[model samples]
Target chain A: MSVTMDKPPVADGAPRPYTLRQPRLPRWTPPALALGAAAVAVGIGIGAGLGSRIQWGLIAGLLFVVGMYALAARVEGRRQAKDRLATSLVWVCFLLAVVPLISLVWETVARGSKVLDGGFLSHSMSGVLTIQPGGGVYHAIIGTLEQVGIATAISAPIGLLTAIYLVEYGRGRLAKAVTFFVDVMTGIPSIVAGLFILSFWIIMLDFGYSGFAGSMALSILMMPVVVRSTEEMLKLVPNELREASLALGVPKWRTILKVVLPTAIGGIATGVMLAVARIAGETAPIVLLVFGSQVINNNPFDGAQSSLPYYIYEQWAAGNEASYDRAWAAALVLIAFVMILNLVARGIARWKAPKTGR
Target chain B: MDITPATSAAPPPLSGAPAPAEQAKSATRPGDRIFLGFSRGSGILLLVIMAAIAAFLAVRAVNALSHNEGNFFTTFEWSANSTPPVFGIAVLAFGTVVSSLIAMLIAVPVAIGVALFVSHYAPRKLATPLSYVIDLLAAVPSIVYGLWGALFLVPHLGGLYSWLNDYLGWTGIFAYHDGAARSLFTIGILLAIMILPIVTSVSREVFLQTPRMNEEAALALGATRWEVIRMSVLPFGRSGVISASMLGLGRALGETMAVATVLSPSFLINTSLLDPGGGTFAQNIASSFKESGEIGKDALIASGLVLFVLTLLVNGAARMIIARRKEYTA
Candidate 1:
């Protein structure tokens, strides 16, 4: 029987039929592919066995999935599966680390919100008992304001001037020494700052526990932060501005005051506020310096004044449910204040960032 | 204009003399020079403040030393209230070092892992939010950490402590006592958690700065993703990791509230990690300052001086390492 074949018509002296070719495999391909796949599977099996406990199960599962991918790739193609597995593993690790942080914030807000009320803000622990839960952090808040405010007042100008001198007028041996000391101070433990202030002011000078002592402790901690931040900000003020002011025959100090500082004021303010925030939640130094008090002490130089940190410690350590509730509320308040300060600092920085384009 | 022209006369310098107007403008006034001098004097004021802090600390520390009765370095006992006072920072120093080392051991690996995960592995959309969460952790006050450790972690760690004791009892470091509620291990763990965010943030930034070309080349060579990270990103960020670790160490060494809350104070030094004793320098100061006698306060001050020196040395080393890396980069 004659069968009709669909074939190309010859343009020249060529055959009209087409030929089918056989697909040939390389001799080493199967064994190499099998070995790689086996190795991956064995590794994953071992990992899975070792990682049966904890979240290691997740890792074991991932390794097994990768092994399966590798085996499948050996049949289809090698590169595509490897890429897919690696990408998947990366995502798993990212999510694993992210979960705890969200949980922590969520827990804090949920637990801390229960006691956050107006009554919690306006009164002190003076009237409330262990069972009753209506006291406020008025004394602690006031003390915190007074002590931290005094500390800022003491630290800001000194730190700013030091930074100004370092960036503007400093060049020689003394400047180097100042820089060295400032670096040392930056590393000094908050406890050491407290000890330094406590020893010098209280033991040596015979001044007892007070908000002033806390301020001194906070100042020691705050100064280094202020100096570092301010120095960075001042350094960022373009050198051309300095030269311009100099060319105008303005005095160096006047140029710094009128031109340089004014230009960098936004950054300087932000830095100062950041420094304040950095020290506001410090508990160690204040614990050492300030005495806990239920009643607010108006004057910083008086005896036994309570700060927010001290208040938290006192309330929590008291071991009463009511006091514990108050402590949580106070913590919430402190955290909110610090958050606000940080936001403000960020805003100032964004607002004052030098305009580059028209 | 016409009146001015009528009154105008030639004001010219004669053969070898200068006009009074020229002389008046030629030299700077002494007052101006004095003002310049005063302005320079402000720099001196800065120096003075710096010197004053150091000087004040030194004097107080010296006073503490002179009044102190026992060998401040070797003696483990801290009996500051006795008439013939016998106390030392040996216990405190040991606690500080041990806790900080424990913290570093826990924090370093986790921090690097997290940093690597975020910078190299995390998707673009997830990275920012993850970093913001870390920032929030950093912003949470130390006292909050203290409360969390005290209320939640301490109670739960008992099981873990027993497990450590059962499995790792041969090693003195992991040995456990009955009371696991207030122990150095808990303090160390809390400190690790507290410093984790700082190290992760800094190291993440550093890892992010790794040269993309090198990473791409490694990947192009058929290297695994982790292999590329090991070969390119880690080497690039080693100095930064070291710096970040030091910063974390600095915080861990000085951390007060968390340690204070987690630990139960004891005078004697115990090697067991789960023992509810061993006070850190900050904890000692915080716990004792209110009730301490004058000599006791001085003793605390003396220990604080040691911590100060230790931290200074640590940060100085970190700065030097960072500076050397900058030089290499330059």
Candidate 2:
């Protein structure tokens, strides 16, 4: 390389300079090209009388990618152009995915805010007619809370114990079988879980529709999520901690109960709460099991109940403008509720992250 | 002796603590025995629940299948309450498969692109927040998506649907007759959007775990950025992406509210997706549950049993792929 630079290279009959320099586009090239593509796309869209700005945007994006690749290849060679093309496509993909998400949130909040007020939150739908406007999700809120609370109560302990069995005491075929079936159980659809309870509790045993039945189905869905998350958290508790406790002559049970549980409690709680958040939004199971009611049913064990998600479905099915507004409001409440749980769960995870200093 | 250390850690032993005779067995102390039993019982209980779900669904499905006057697999109408009840899953099965197929086709490529962008293309500051947003988006409930799809998306999709019909109507699948945009095609798009976040996050994780040395070696060899990714990253992440897509497909197949809310259910199978006349199993069960009698409920359960088995197969395939990939990596 030094010899080539010092003395010019002789190619065929001509002498040429041997320098390590390649032609490259300026940093502003992409943005400038994109602006040109947008202008051209908009001009064509206006001339052709395209109905949607989305069509124009798609045209602009396509032009930008093609134009960038052509100009880059001319100046900077094939490899650099290919790289730029890939980067631009990735950006396009990112924008495409993000736009709908933002729209979904923005639409929900904008429309949901119209009917979401104190009265809307406090009253039940019992007195309100399906075609008439004013109603609230108070009954649904009560039903969701009770049903989800009961589900959490039933599943959290069993899930925790199952996770403990897998992590702490698991050995041989039983443990392996438990682990395999847990993975299988995780994939059971919420509707299928409801169907299971439907066949068993409602049909076979001749029981009436109740939120308690919904809770049973929910626990089925919740259990696997809980077990998976808790198992991960428990695994994060270093084996050294367990060994340390056991080396002190502490019994195995005491070591697990005192040392391990305390160490992982924050993570365990976070997992449980996240699982609750997941099951709380479930509508399919509740639709089949709780058998949604219009009035507030305080007793989850005795009668049919409504939930936030179920209310949304029911209101939407009513298919009127007023019912549509109520559905939006309920959806807003459900999103906010689930988001809060998620934020708090993540916060707990961070606050109580194991300080093993690994 | 073990009891002594454990009890000594506290100020006082409880009155219900096991007697000395029971505690004398060091390995089989009453506390250990009971805890083991309790935890093991919980594990066994989970297995039982899984078994019970399959057993109950299968039994009911069989019972319903036996009483059908029409061929259960061939009949198109779902009237379980009629005399000599006859209902079949031909249309439901067709609708479910086609809608989920459409969803998978649209979602998988876009998800891989988003995953690649988050893992490799975006700057660190941008990548972190972008991925966090994706994570939160995944947690957004499907019912919310269903509502949004019904109210917002259906109305807005008119132009695009017309555009597709105009350009691709020669293909029978894209034909449209100026009907409401509540169709299997629309449901497919909604399901795609709903499952995108999950597929993207999983693939992003796999892309992030691509061995750094492999990537750097390609880079050091003067390969372009895209070449480096193509040679080292995509190959390593291929199985991961496949499994991620399978997971998304499983979700799309079993999704209820979004399809139920978006698609106008009809018992007949339609050749054109743009026509609002196809019904999925989950959607059928959901929309039909309200008015169904005992026999109707039993029929819904039978359809749900099919859905359960379908998801199980998809999920099982995904798990197998993941398990195989693990062995390769290890």
| lDDT tens readout by residue for model 1, A157-246 | 778877877888778897777776676677667777777677678766887789999898788788877888888888888888889987
Residue A212 in candidate 1 has what lDDT?
A: 91
Candidate 1 CAPRI-style tier: acceptable
Model 2: per-residue Cα lDDT at residue B59: 91
TM per candidate comes to 0.81, 0.93
Which whole-number lDDT from 0 to 100 does residue B254 have in model 2?
88
CA error at residue B315 for candidate 2, angstroms: 0.7
Give a tens-digit lDDT track for model 2, residues B51-151.
Answer: 89889999998888888888788899999988789999999999999999999998998899999999999999999989988988988998999999999
DockQ, cand. 1: 0.28
Each candidate's interface RMSD, rounded to one decimal?
Answer: 4.7, 1.1
Separately for all candidates shown, the number of backbone clashes (residues 3 or more apart, or on different chains) is 0, 0
Who wins the DockQ comparison? Answer: 2
Docking class of 2: medium
List the candidate 1 regions with Cα displacement exceeding 4 Å: A1-100, A130-132, A356-358, B1-70, B177-180
Q: In candidate 1, what are the lDDT values of residues B161-239, reduced to their tens digit?
A: 6666778988987788776469887888788888889889989998998889999999998666766887899899999
Please give the lDDT score at residue A263 for candidate 2: 95
